[model samples]
Target: MDRRVYGAEPSERDPGPKPGRAYVELVGGPLDGMLLDVTGWPPQEVVDGAVLMSEHGAFGPGGRSGYEPAEAVAGAGGVGRFVWRGDVP
Candidate 1:
């Protein structure tokens, strides 16, 4: 498996393996206490997604989203929810 982690502009990171489903809550940022519904994605991806959300956020291309799974969730055959939390820098 390709374990060369990168985030926030091609920088290397090591969040280890994070399999299955869980929620990654953001802390001390604009999006604090926001639960990211991560399904079958590694923990690094979740954190990176949250970070990108916090950094760029809304109506823009978020670069370098790490560790995305093959299957697509959110607005599929089942119900899905979307939440946004962030502050203008």
Candidate 2:
């Protein structure tokens, strides 16, 4: 049987980039160091941005972390970056 690992982790620990899977690195803000899986999304959707909810965010209950697509990094295994805009109430 083959052993495999799943879910988000620091880039340094990753074996390599996964083909056919798209990811966005959540930079800064409360949800920093997190990877958002955006697989199967078209270019436009990626640019549109995302608002993810976090129970542990600064605002506590009903808090949302907003992110906008930023420059793509090749060294990050082609993983795109999403800069934190701000937290929404």
Q: List per-prediction Cα lDDT, in the order shown.
A: 0.36, 0.68
Model 1 lDDT-worst window of ten: 63-72
Candidate 2 minimal-lDDT segment of 10 residues = 1-10
In angstroms, the error of model 1 at 36 is: 1.0
Q: Model 2 segments beyond 4 Å from truth? A: 1-20, 72-77
Judged by TM-score, which candidate is best? 2
Q: Write the per-residue lDDT of candidate 1 for residues 38-57, one digit (tens) a residue.
A: 55655445434433443443
Candidate 2 TM-score, C-alpha based: 0.67
Instruction: Kindly report which residue stretches of model 1 are placed more than 4 angstroms away from their true locations once superposed.
Output: 1-21, 43-50, 55-89
> Which lDDT value does model 2 have at 26?
79
